[model samples]
Target chain A: EAGVAQSPRYKIIEKRQSVAFWCNPISGHATLYWYQQILGQGPKLLIQFQNNGVVDDSQLPKDRFSAERLKGVDSTLKIQPAKLEDSAVYLCASVTSPAADTQYFGPGTRLTVL
Target chain B: DQQVKQNSPSLSVQEGRISILNCDYTNSMFDYFLWYKKYPAEGPTFLISISSIKDKNEDGRFTVFLNKSAKHLSLHIVPSQPGDSAVYFCAARADDYKLSFGAGTTVTVRA
Candidate 1:
């Protein structure tokens, strides 16, 4: 079975610019998640989706950050007017179901905002 | 507020020795505890986990100990190998389906 896949291993953008990241989760996986990991920090949950519907997104920055899991197989996370503080590695993860204990993670997209 | 915390920023251990990483949680409601090992440029992988009802769980060379009363847990790696050198993250999950993570501890196994 294939693990979670993410696009654009690395990205660089200027402050106030917009950036987007994509994620394709493992087959048969019913839950997907997006996380942000700042340097020297662990991954922090940004949003979660279960079968095309959002399960939780309380930590997401509604003013500038948004994500969607249309069709429930692939997902995308976008940040508009990115700020310097947004420079971090964005990770995508998945689990077979919401009740599963183990989560498979993707390589992640390292975003650097200038 | 960060619910999980790994106070040690880093640890250096000689090969064939034991490596112990500690984590503390502020929330007592977490149902499961897990540890993840991450390499540079790669995402984290599950190492070992312990449920809230269990005090200890072991797999191969890794063992996880949970102390519910103190809201603390630990991971012990015996006979550490070079491949074991990586950042270790302690995470907790509740019924809300959210995994709260700590600021990982980097462990370097020396030969």
Candidate 2:
């Protein structure tokens, strides 16, 4: 089976600029997720979508970050007014369902904010 | 605070030797634990998993042991191979299906 797919394997932006990352999950998967991985740290959950509906986004910084899944197949994560601290890899993952344990991950978009 | 932690940042072992990586979790509510392997420039791939009810699960040359009372778990790779060199992440899952991950352990298998 084809794995999750993401765009712009790498990105660079200046502080105060906006950036967006895209993700296309595995076909037939019902759950999608966005995560942020800073250097030396593991992936941290940013938001979760269950068939285009948000299931969890408590850890997301609403003031700067937002994410959406359309048609339950593709997703986009956006960061406005990017800061230096926003320099990290944005990873997208998917699972067969919300209750499924094994998650498939994409190559990720490495965002560098200068 | 991170609920899951891999205290050892890195480990080096000779090929054909045993490699053991450890992880500790702070939450008792976590009912499932998983291990993921990652290479440079690539996303993590699922390696193995164990449920709360089981104390040990083994697959081929890999084995995972969970100690509920100690809130600790470990992954053992026997006869490590050069291809096994990668970052290993330990993750815990709650009933909500959200996962908490560790910083990861970088294992280097030397020839």
Give candidate 2 regions above 4 Å deviation.
none
Best by DockQ: 2
Worst 10 residues of 1 chain A by lDDT: A95-104
- Alpha-carbon interface RMSD for all candidates, in angstroms: 0.7, 0.5
- Model 2 achieves a DockQ score of 0.90
lDDT by residue (A51-114, candidate 1, tens digit) is: 8999889899989999999999999999998999999999999998977988999999999999
DockQ, every prediction: 0.88, 0.90
For model 1, the stretches where C-alpha displacement exceeds 4 angstroms are: none
Please write out the lDDT profile of model 1 over residues B7-108, one tens digit for every residue: 999999999999999999999889899999999999999999999999999999999999999999999999899999999999999987689999999999
TM-score of chain B of 2: 0.99
| TM-scores, all models, native as reference | 0.98, 0.99
Candidate 2's residue-wise lDDT over B26-68, tens digit each? 9999999999999999999999999999999999989999999
What TM-score is obtained for chain B in each of the predicted models? 0.99, 0.99
Quote the lDDT for B24 in model 2.
Answer: 100
